[model samples]
Target chain A: MSAEAQTCPALDAKELDRLRGLCRQARIDLLRSIANAGAGHTGGAMSLVEIVTALYFRVMRVDPARPDWPERDRFILSKGHSSPGLYAALAARGYFPKERLSEFDVAGGMLQGHPDMLKTPGIDMSTGSLGQGLSVGIGMALAGRLKGLNVRVFVLAGDGEMQEGQVWEAAMYAGFHKVSRLVLIVDCNSIQLTGRTDETLSLAPLAGKLEAFGWRCVECDGHDLADLVPALERAVAVEDGPVCVIARTEKGHGVSFIANRVEWHAKAPTPEQLAQAIAELEGAK
Target chain B: MAETGLTYTVYDADHMTQAEIYGAVLTRLGGERPDIVALTADLAKSTKIGKFGEKYPERFFNVGIAEQNLFGVGAGLALAGFTPFISTFAVFTSLRAAEQVRTDICYQKLNCKIIATHSGVSFGQAGTTHHCTEDISVMRSFAGMTVIVPADGIETAKAVAACCDWEGPVYIRIGRGFEPRCYENDQYDFQIGKSIQMADGSDLTVIACGPSVQHAVEAAKVLKAEAGLSVRVLNMHTIKPIDKDAIISAVHDTRRIITAEDHSTIGGLGTSVAEVIAETGKSCLLRKLGIPDQFAIVGYPDDLYNHYKIDADGIIEAANAIMGTELEADEDWEDEF
Candidate 1:
C-alpha cells in the first residue's frame, strides 16, 4: 500500500526496545527545552511521549529525509500544546537536525508556540485550536481514498480538550464515512487546565460512547510501549470503520513531583524542579 | 439534476436569483476540474449546492449541521491540494465559524472559497437570526480575505468563475432569491477588486453593492429623466480591496456622493467609501443611506428595503438630499461619531 517497506513490523521485540530507548531520551529532550525557555507546557508534552514515539519510529511508514513524500503516513498533534513531545520525536526520527530543537521556546520562528505546517517540515497540519485536528485527519484520509493511496492518518487528541463540541462533530463525520486508515489516540492524561476534565464537563463512559458512534475502541497503558504498540496495530487493521485508542496516561509522566499534579498543566519547571526531573529520568539508566 | 423544488423561471431576469447561478457554475466547475469539491453544512437545497451534489456525488460532502467543522474540513481539504467550496448561510459562516475561518483558513491563507448565501435581509421574514446584515463588516476585517458581493444572478456566475483562479480565501455574499438582474448579460469582463461604472454622469455619484446596485441603477435612470441630474452609478461588487481610486475620482468629479447597501452603514460598503473620502482630504457632501445601526423589523425584503430607504425611490431621495447639503469645511470635523 505504501512505497516504503517496513523493516520494523508490529510486535517486533528488538524494534520495540530500540523505540523505548528513544522515548526516554525524547522525554529528556522535552524536559530540557521547555525548562530552557523558562516557559511552556510541560505536563501534556511529557504525557504524550510514548504514543508519539511509537507512531514516529516503529509503526508509521515514513522517511525523515523526504517529509513530503505523497505516500508517507501523517501524524497530527491535535493537542498541539504537546509540541515539545512531537518535536523531540521528529528530531529522533531525523525529520530535521537534532540541533533544531533549540528553536522551540520563547524566541520562536522555526517552531512557533503552536505547531505550524508552514514552519515545520514533518508536521502534516497546523493545529493549536483544540478539536480541529481530527477533521483535518478525516480530510487527508478522504483525499487518500480518492487518490487510491494507502496512506495512514494518526491524530493525538487530549482527553481534556474533548469538551469542545467540534470534536463530537468530527467524530460523527469520521464514523459515518467509514474512513479507513485513520487512527485517533486520545491521550487521556486525566488532567487539564483549571481542573480534571470530568469535573469541568464529564466525558466518562467515553469508550462506550465512541463505540456507539461506530468506532472500534481500545484501551492501553500509554507509558508502556509494549502495551501501546500492539493496541495501535489493532487499530490500523480495522477496515469497517475508524479506531479510537484511549491511552490512559498520567500528566507529567516522567517527572516524579509533577506527575498527576494539577499545577504542572502549563507551568514552567523551576531550576530545582528541572534538576530533580533530570535525576528522576536519569536514574532509570 | 434532480428537481428539489428550488427551480424558478428566468422570466426576463425578474424571477432569477444569484443562488441559482451559484449552483449552476459550481456544478460546471466540478465537471471541468476534478480538483474542485463542494461542501454544505446541511444546506444543500437551501443554498442550492445540491445541484453539485447530484452531479458529483463522489466529490460532494454534506458535513451535516456543523458549520465550524465545515470550515475546518474545508481548510484540511485545501491543504490536501483540493479547491474546496464551502456553502452555507452568511450568518453561520461569519459568526459560528469565525474563529475557524480566521485561524484555520485566513491565517494559513488556504485556497478555499466560502459562498455565503442569504446575506443581508434576504431572508427577511425569517427574523434577525436568519438575516445577516453584519457579514460584510466582519468578513472585511480578516487579512488576506477577498470579499465580493454580486448584484444579481449574472454577476454571481461571473464572480464565481473569477474566484476559481484567484488565490487565497474568498467570501462571495449573495441574497436568498430573486435578486433582479443588474447586468444585461454575463458576457462583460469582471475583476475581483475593481468597480464597474454602470452609468456615467457629472452631477453626483451613487455607489452601491449587492442588492442595492440594481436599485441604484434604476434610480440613476429616474434621476436623469425627472430631476435633470446627470448621475454616475458604480457597482462596487468587491468590498475588501475596494476601488479607492473610483471613490476619490468621484469626489473630484462630483463633490456630492451617496453610498447604499442592504446592510448596516457601520462596516459595509458605505463605511469603506467613507474611509477613502476622509483619507484623501476631500470635502464632499457624502451621505450613507443604509439600515441604521439596528436590527431590521421582520417583514418581506421589499417592505424592509422600502422602510429603510434602500429601495429605488429611497436612493433617489438620498441622491437629491445630498446635492442640496453644504460641503464640510476642512477644519476639524464637526462630526457625529
Candidate 2:
C-alpha cells in the first residue's frame, strides 16, 4: 500500500478496486433505475460514478451511523440532476436501505428526482438549481473553519454548470480566503445537456483557469483508479489554498453504447438494454 | 400607593439614531458573547457594525463587496454553531443578496441574524437603487424570518442583543446616521413580536415603526397641542407577527388609524396593519403615510423622508386626514360576530 493510502483509514487499493466494481454496478443500477422510471440523467451520472465512488468509499470520513456527525466531511453534488449515481453510492455505504434504490423517483420515495438534504440521508445540501451547490458547500466549509473543526468539504461541479457566473464568484472567494480544506472536483465529461461544452460555452484550458484563480490544480484520468488515487492524495496534501481536481472523464462511461454520446445524457435504458448492461458489468466483475 | 415598587426611569435621550445604538449595543454584546461573529460586505464602516468588528477581530468576517457570498458564508458559519450577525446596507442585503438569504438561510431555517443598516430612505443620497424602502415587505414575506425595525439607536442595540436567543432567521433593520435616540437606557424588555405603546389617546391612533416611529411620537405632541387630536402612538417595531391586538383595539376605541413607516406604501407597515384590520372587518378611517408607489428621487435621507411624507409633518397630516374622514359603522357588526 502507498503511504498516502495507508494514512487514509477509509481508502486502500482493495477498497478502490471494490469501489470500481461498485461504480460499474452503480452505472448499471442507474441505467436500470432510470429505465424503470422511464426518465433520468444517464450521461452525467455515468461520468460522476468514479468520482462519487472515490469520495464516498475512499475519501470522505463520513459515518453512515451518524449522518450529521459534526466533524464528518461534507460532499455537495452541485450537478444534482445526476443523483442516481449518488443514490446508489449512498445505498452501498448503508446511508439508507439498499432496497430503497429501486424506489427512486417513485411516488412518496425518500429519494426524489433531485437530492434533498431534508429527505435524503446522505445529501448534505438540497440541490436541483444549478450554480447553487457551490455556495452551500462554501457555507459548510466556512462553518467548519469558524468552529475550528477538522471537517473538509468536497463539491462536485459539472463542466456545464461552470457556465454560471456564481461559480466563478465562489471560486474567486475560495481562492481569496485560501480555503485549503475545500476540494472542488470537476467532472469534465466535455458534454452538457444540450451539446458539446466547447460548442455550448468554451471552458477550454480548465486547469489553467483554476490555477489563475489561486487553486492548486490537478488533472487525472477519472476512470483509472491508479491516477484518481494519487490526484486525490495530492489534493488533500495541499495545506494552504483550495484544490481543484479536473478529472478527464467520459460521459456514460463503462457503457460502450452510451459512452461519449450526448443523446444518452438523460435517456433511460430499455429492459433489453438494462439486461445487456448488467451482463457486461457482471462479466467485468 | 405612595411609593410605586421599584419605579424605573425611562430616559428620553435625543439625537442618536438607531444605527448608532446598534453599533454601541453590538460592541457591548461582543464582551458577553464570544460566539457572536459579525460580517460586512465591504460596508462595515458605513453600516456601523464596524464598531463590533473593530472590538472583536477574531469574531469578525469581512467578505468584501460580495453580498451573495456574505450571506452564504454567514449562513455557513451559523450552521457550524456560530452566531453570525451579517451587516450591510438594507438595499444590498435585501435586493442584491435576496436569493442567498432566502435559499441558504431562511429556507434552511439557519440561526443567522441579518443586521441591515440604512434601511428605507436612509441611504437617500446613494440614489434610487440604494434606497431600501421595500425591504420590510420583502423580508416579511420570506418564511421563517423575524422582521424587526427598531425605533431608534437604543432599540437597535436592544434588538441586536435580543437576537442572541432568537431562534431561526432574523432581519433587523436600522436607519442611517443622525437618528434621534428613542430609549434612555436598556431598561425595558424588548420582545420579538410585541409592540410598545408610547402614548395613549382616544381620538386617533398613529401606528409607526423604524425611523418613522420618532416622527409619530413628535406628531402626537403636535396633534395634541394644535389640533386637539389625542393621538395614540404605537412604536410597532416588530413588523412581522405584528401586534394585531394593538391595531384591533386602537381601531375599536379610536375609530381612526394612521400608519407611518419609512418604507414603501405597498407591503410594509401600512399593508401589515391594513391586513389585520381587514381580517377583523372593522371599518375604521385608515391612511397609510409612506413613500408612494414610485422610486424615490435621489437626495439625502431627510429629503427623501420629507418627499415621501413619512416625516413628523407628514404623520401629522395623515393623522388629520384620517381624523377628518368618517367610516360608516356596520349596523349588524355585533350580529355578525
Candidate 3:
C-alpha cells in the first residue's frame, strides 16, 4: 500500500495539523527560493502558499512516483509568476528532491522563470502568457470526460490576469459546456504588475461577473483555512458546470513589511528582509 | 464535322482535386481514429469538415466564432496529447489566428493539424475578407510549419492521412465547396515536400499548386494542341520545402517557367520559385500568374479565378508570353554570367 493509504485511517486530526505545518514550511521555503533568485514574484507567491499547500497535501490524488498516471488530477498554475510557491509545494509533496529548491532560477536549473511543463516535474502545462492556461485546463477536462477518466483539473488565475480577453472566453466556454470536473481559483490579491487592479482596470463585482458567466462563485478569505477548506469542498461537490473560488488574499500575507504591498509583486526580498520575513512567519506559528 | 466521343483514361480521372477527397477521407479516418479530435469555427459545413464532425459528434469541437482561441485551445489540446485537427476558413486561420498559431503551436512545436478551408479565391462570392489569397505566403513564412495546398479533395484526403504521421505543426489548405476533385484514388501516395509532375515537355514549364494545378495541366493540353508548345506541368503542392531540384531542372531544361497559384504574386509560389531561380543564375524566362497587387473583385469562385486570370487560359497566356522571349544562346550567356 502507499504511504498516504497506510496512514489514512489513523491520526485524522494529527495529519491535518501536520499538513498545516507542511504549508507553513512551504511558505518559508517559498520566501527563501525567491530570496535566492533575487528577482521573482514574491507577493502573489506568498498569497497562494496556503492553497497550494492544501491541494498538494490534503486534496489532490497525486503519486510523485507516477507523475504521468492517466487518472491523476492536474493542477495548472495559470498565474505562472508564482513558481516559487509551486516549486516549494511540489518539493514538500516529494515531487522532486527538496534539495532542488536551491537550484531555483540557477542556470541549467529545471525551475525556469515561468512554468515549463517539459522542464519541471508534475507541471501539466507551460503557462506564463496570461489567459491561456484556463483554456488548456478546460481541454484537459474535456479530454478526461471524453476518455471517461475520473480525473479533475484545477486552474489558479490571478485577478490581474483575468483582465485578459481569452480568460473570459475560456470562462464562457467552461460554463456553457457545463464542465463540472473543472475548478478555477482566482487569486484575488487585488494587485497587478502596474498597481492595484482597480487602478489598472476595474474588475469590481468580480464574483457577479463570474456568476453571470454561469460559474458557482465562492468567496472566502484565501488565507483562512476554515473558509478555504469548506469553499473548496463545496466547489468539488457541485455536479453541473464549473466552479470559481474568488480567493480574497493579500498580495503578501505572511510578512509584515511586504504584506498588501504592490512593490513586492515580483520583487525579491533582501537578506535582511528575508530574515525578518522568516521571523514573522515563525511568530505566527 | 465528325462526331468524336473522346474517352478520358482512368489516369486522367485519378487526378481528382484533394479538397473533395479530404472530406470523405476525414469522415472515414474519424471512424477509425477515435482520438482524432475535430474543431471548427462556425464554418463546418462550408469547409466540408462537417462530414467528419457529423460522423463523430463526441470527438468534434465547434468553438463558435473565435479563431484565435480556436488555435490556442487546439494547441492546449495537442499539449495534452490529443491529436487535434482545427478547421476554419483559411483567411481567419492564417491571418486572424496567425499570432496564436505562431506562438502557441509553431513556437512550441505542437502536434496540431490546421486544416484551413476556403483557401484562395475558393470563396469568390464572399468578397475579399473571406477569400484566403495570402494564406500560403503567411503560413509558409512561419518557422517549423509544414504548408500544403492540395490540388483537390482526393489530394486533401491524402494530405490529411499524411499529416497524421507528421510529428509537428502542419498547415493544410483546401478549397471551398464543390472544388473539382483532383486525385485518382486512395492508392496514390502524398508526400509533404515532394512535387508531382503532371505532364512532361521541353519548351516551357508551368508550376502550380492548389486549384491552379488543374488549370496548369489543362493549359498544357491547350498549349500542345493549339500553339504546338511543349509545356511541362508540375503540381507544386508543398510550398515550404519546395522541390528545388524540380525548379532547377525546369530552368535548365525548359528555360521558360510560369508559376500559377490562387494567391498574391508577391510572396506565394512566384516568390518561392524566383528565390530558387535567382540562386542558380539560369537564363530562364519566368512569369508569375496569381491575384494582382489590387484587392480581388467580388464574384463566384470560378468567375473570380477567371477575373484574376488564374485559370488554364491565364497559364497558357503566361507560357506563350515567356515562350516568345528568345532563349539566351551559349555565346551571350557566358559573358553575362
Q: Write the per-residue lDDT of candidate 1 for residues A1-285, one digit (tens) a residue.
A: 233565366566777778778888998888877887777789999999999988887788888878888878888899998899899999888888888887887565587668988889899888899988888888788877877888889989999888888988989998887888999999999988988888987889999888877888999999988899889988987887899999999999977888998899888788888888888888876
Where does the lowest 10-residue lDDT sum fall in candidate 3 chain A? A1-10
Give per-candidate clash totals: 0, 3, 22
Q: Write the per-residue lDDT of candidate 2 for residues B154-265, one digit (tens) a residue.
A: 6776677777788889999887776765655647877889999989999999899987888888889999999998889999999988988899888787878899898899
TM-score of every candidate relative to the true structure: 0.94, 0.91, 0.86
- Interface Cα root-mean-square deviation for all models: 1.1, 1.9, 1.8
Clashing pairs in 1: none
lDDT of 1 by residue, B104-160 (tens): 889878899999998999899999999998999999999999999988877787788
Flag regions of model 2 displaced more than 4 Å: A1-13, A32-39, A102-108, A256-258, A263-284, B1-16, B334-337
lDDT of each: 0.86, 0.82, 0.81
Q: Residue B261 deviation, candidate 1, in Å?
A: 1.4
Better model by TM-score, 2 or 3? 2
